[model samples]
Target chain A: MATDRIRDFIRTTRPDGPCLVVDLDVVRDNYRAFERALPDSRIFYAVKANPAPEVLKLLADMGSNFDTASVREIELAMEAGADATRISYGNTIKKERDIARAHALGVSLFAVDSHEEVEKIARAAPGARVFCRVLTSGEGAEWPLSRKFGCVPQMAVDVLVYAHQLGLTSYGVSFHVGSQMTNLDAWDAAIADSKYVFDKLARQGIVLEMVNMGGGFPTRYLKDVPSAEAYGQAIKGALIDHFGNQLPETIIEPGRGMVGNAGAIKAEVVLVSRKSDLGENRWVYLDIGKFGGLAETMDEAIRYPITTDRDADEMEPCIIAGPTCDSADVLYENTPYPLPISLTIGDEVLIGGTGAYTTTYASVAFNGFEPLRSYVI
Target chain B: MATDRIRDFIRTTRPDGPCLVVDLDVVRDNYRAFERALPDSRIFYAVKANPAPEVLKLLADMGSNFDTASVREIELAMEAGADATRISYGNTIKKERDIARAHALGVSLFAVDSHEEVEKIARAAPGARVFCRVLTSGEGAEWPLSRKFGCVPQMAVDVLVYAHQLGLTSYGVSFHVGSQMTNLDAWDAAIADSKYVFDKLARQGIVLEMVNMGGGFPTRYLKDVPSAEAYGQAIKGALIDHFGNQLPETIIEPGRGMVGNAGAIKAEVVLVSRKSDLGENRWVYLDIGKFGGLAETMDEAIRYPITTDRDADEMEPCIIAGPTCDSADVLYENTPYPLPISLTIGDEVLIGGTGAYTTTYASVAFNGFEPLRSYVI
Candidate 1:
């Protein structure tokens, strides 16, 4: 957690090119720590966060289940020796082949958001287990998948009853409040909704045994954000409180929380320029531009970039843009640069907070630079 | 451009899976169209748009130059049979290896943005053909390379003088206003800036033979965007006005404008649901979400979907979202879904306007999806 430790890691490594260095020790420890925190509930490692087979293998080795949203991801988890029974295909938008593949792989658990998906699964994989997805409300919830995927609570009850009539066993209820969720009350409300569905299904003589609280526990993107442990405990406590003792063998899928801070992108500075017209500035262009690993922040607000140049003290403000011709390419806005830091032409800079949705989520095509060569600690 | 024609392509081919379908015929037509429109100017096919060797070969066969920004891309163009002398390394960020490789490959034309870059290139590729990039104020000028790479006009004069002193030939002046340019006046303004730089270099006793008017001609995103022919002619006429009979040999690099509409993503409609709260709304989720090919639309608003459902006339408004669990995964918002369209559960939807940046430039990580399968049409 100390800057000195990161500095030491960078100094000893001295990478020859643009790359990503991952502390496998930190990652494995983080995985094990999350699992230890929720010993009672099964952990479905969300593969969408970081789908590297090695990482999946690490989680599988740690006795963690996986939540796959696609057929190929399911295949990857299974190839990594994940328990087929423990694998849950949680995607609401299901292709026919996807369902058949999951069924062929003996994956019993499936997430169903629409009645159309339920019918498709029934026709394709008649014996697979299914769960009801309920829609809950929240602000900044732009384009809610609930509106696009899940049915109303009453509609979900009808789907469950219809499943029972069609000889399909409905064993669980699942709801995703949203990603980067800051409201614990949203999770609490979703848990309450799941209980209502559970009771309604029970009235129809159907007993549910699983309640999947889909993961969205935020990683502290900035200071003052709640820690993952605090987020996890709050949700877990709500699940227990809502369902009392019959919480249906709870399962939590924490994607970003487990891997968001365990890695960093290491890039070398390519150029440094000074501009007087743009409010007096110094600019450092790195070889690791929007093409390499910073593509996500290409046009958003100011991105946070830190210099790895050693023995620096005085600071100045400068803009960091990528090498691509696209005007949209920028790494950060008028960002601070340590002025006294003797930034030679070819110094190094480490782009931090890139562990979760970076290499595993984005592509590098601008300069034909693939994701950085990842090194496990 | 008929709906039936697109459907024929998808149904007849039944390719392996979701992949890039590059219509070589369409690309060749685009290439020849641009060449014929600006018969006098040089056309440098920006390989960053579609680095597939065949595409490069098609352009190279037609007597076009290659615009590369990295050592890897330059080498790829060469491997694809591009003449070393005809390739211009227009990258602003110069790595040590990049300069060395350009020198080794005998690619003389280069874009120099900084005095340090000039020094590095002079040391590495001593006799390389260099162009001093200048900043131009225009309507769409943003994320200016001048901020990261270009020298000021005065500094450019100094750099040109210094390069002459170092026995390095300053071949020309180059400037990129921006990408996806809608304002054609930006091209005129850039040419004016190029003339100023050329004149200043001439005063410094650095005679130039070429004026590289950097790329960013508009491609048709919406119907109202200017046609390539109109924009190309406007630029050509402006170059003639600025340089008159002594007009230097010209070079133009077009990435998206060349391949933007040459291909599309054909995805199947997987799940359909209705939003009761949002009124009588129906949502059709595609098998190919953001990962499949909708990655380019993640930033700007772009929707070029063509429904193959036979009942196209019965169109209605529907929101389409990708299959990813991320809440921000809406592919198209409030788009009209034609009725009588065959977009039932398993029908296919061809997403157009994806030929340029969507294939290689977008995110391809989650779902373990393969890159767009490319086929020469």
Candidate 2:
């Protein structure tokens, strides 16, 4: 629905180049929807998603906590006038210096998935709250990040236990099913896996006080997906089934699911033509591409819902490419995302569901194309 | 080697964080090597490869022409003191306004892969020197970019003829085998492909003046690639075989090959530990990742040779990861890259062979981690 306004906005404004437009009204609505869906859980907005100044300020004013990944993020959150206590250093892989800097800045909460990080945190900020992350299968998520992060149940238990021994506060267990989690029950396996860690720690007389249901909330895209409310019910069912009557202080960190629907990008079709006589579709080249902002195409893993001036007309499968010198900059080659054959140069393509993981994720100066221009309304 | 100066400089300067140290001396040597190899071709350094001020300044001083992709890059090259006339707006896909602006800025050369672009260039920069790009198989390249660019023989010929009909100057034909291309003979197929376009265009009464050998020049990385001179000799042989001494002015546009080995990066290992008992390799987490920098490790497509303080001793297979919250930040998951087990927190891991695509290809503000800092020596 927001895309309608955004499309018309682009048509009327006619922004000369590719621009990421933010409707603050849509962001507020998404936040309210999430708040209504998960009333009891503390919401920590992942700062990695759309770290625009205005977006941060809006969320902070609305009293949303921040899940920061690095020292710079922690500083940015604080600079946005967010209370230091509202920020958590959420990346498990962290530098010792960043950990120390966060500690010196009065930040207490941190995420750790390994013994090495546990030791680093202990030396940097003893008695700080540290959550151990559990690895999931990362199945059914558009952007599965299973390989880079998380630990097994036994490893998570060991990491938390070791953190306790080293005089750091073992906060709880956290698990991310992966970004853009489509299968609502994807968290079921990880939630059930966390029980092992909780039971083992309780046996050791270290009572866990919290459980972090990490972010994987899917955003609306071209493909069919479960609603956010359905995601809430599925997660609620998992938490209830696992924790039962012993549910701790629950927290949820949402990155894409929060801001994705709030933003839209308008990219002018720089050129449109049939690549070759054998090729059936036209090559639709846009100003914003893999390097120029829209990097989350992730090889079509998370397809962004696209709209154009000729949407009502007949559509043809076109090879969508970014305007870059790199051949790898093709946004969707095999992904049969159809566009209007009538789509021509100077025609604007409004990319919906780009509120998160767009501008901030682009190369600073790839191909000399300017990083995506951002606007907040 | 520039890495040697960078290493000593790091040891002396003691940079506090991840830094891309570029050696201008190495760049000069690389330029001279290419100059010696392709004596007939004008060397247009692909600005997108590094685009560092000092690097551009050095190349410009050595009379290297610049292949610019965007208006910003053209401005950067000019600001770096490169003569504007020596710069070519080489990307086939460009906005009409940008095309006009480049013409306004005194750039007359452009690349075209389709009739649509030819029309745009004709409208924006009438009579500009234009080159038509021919498609290749992209075989034998460490980083293949075949899908996003290039047109087939028929389309390339059509484009050039169309440009001629539209009263614009059709400069020549261009073809890219791929980036970090191995097989020195890979250019042979494309050279043959260009002959058809050349013969067809000549039949249409359009005389071509040049043939651009688009950059795929390999840099020294983990795998051994052909020397720039070898690539030149192979290309020269192919041109002579096909053209039979009727060869026109040849042009070479080198991005990675020119600056890839001229730079190195130093990133501290944030943590080192086993991902899990099931996963065999220890996870070597660096402060930099796909976002912080080092994005060329595309599923181990272009593996950069690595070095560390404990390089001489026993080594074990390790999964290299960036210190980011995104799971996709893992550099080499299944590559079985080995590092000394003694590598621990705070150990500096020098990622050699990273000069070409590291800093210029990272997410600008991902995970709130800072962009890769660059130092020119």
Which 10-residue span in candidate 1 chain A carries the lowest summed lDDT? Answer: A138-147
- Cα lDDT for residue A302, model 2? 71
Tens-digit per-residue lDDT, A1-377, candidate 2? 35566666776887777889888888787788778888888899898997888888998999899999888888888888898899999988887878899999999999998998999999988889999988888888788875667788898888899999999888899988888888877888888888888899999988888888889887888777687788779878988999898877888998888889889888788888776888677788888888878888767777788887699999888888888888888888886679987787888778888989998888888887767888887
Chain A superposition TM-score, candidate 2: 0.96
Residue-wise C-alpha lDDT for candidate 2, range B216-275, written one tens digit per residue? 888988767778778879989999988887987888888888889988888888888876
Tell how far residue A266 is off in model 2, in angstroms. 1.0
Q: List the candidate 2 regions with Cα displacement exceeding 4 Å.
A: A1-13, B277-279
Q: Best-fitting candidate, measured by DockQ?
A: 2
lDDT of 1 by residue, A1-377 (tens): 31344556767978677666655565677777676666677889888877776777878887888998888889889888897987999887778887887898888788886677778788878867889888777442211333555677877887777776777788788887765567767788888888998899899889988778877665554444465567668877887889877757778887766775666777777777653333456677776665555655634421434545563556566577666655445676644444333665777677665666667555546666655566655
lDDT of 1 at B57: 82
Q: Which CAPRI tier for candidate 2?
A: medium
Q: Which runs of model 1 end up more than 4 angstroms from their true locations?
A: A1-15, A136-152, A221-224, A275-279, A295-312, A334-341, B2-9, B136-159, B221-225, B275-280, B334-342, B362-364
Worst 10 residues of 2 chain B by lDDT: B272-281
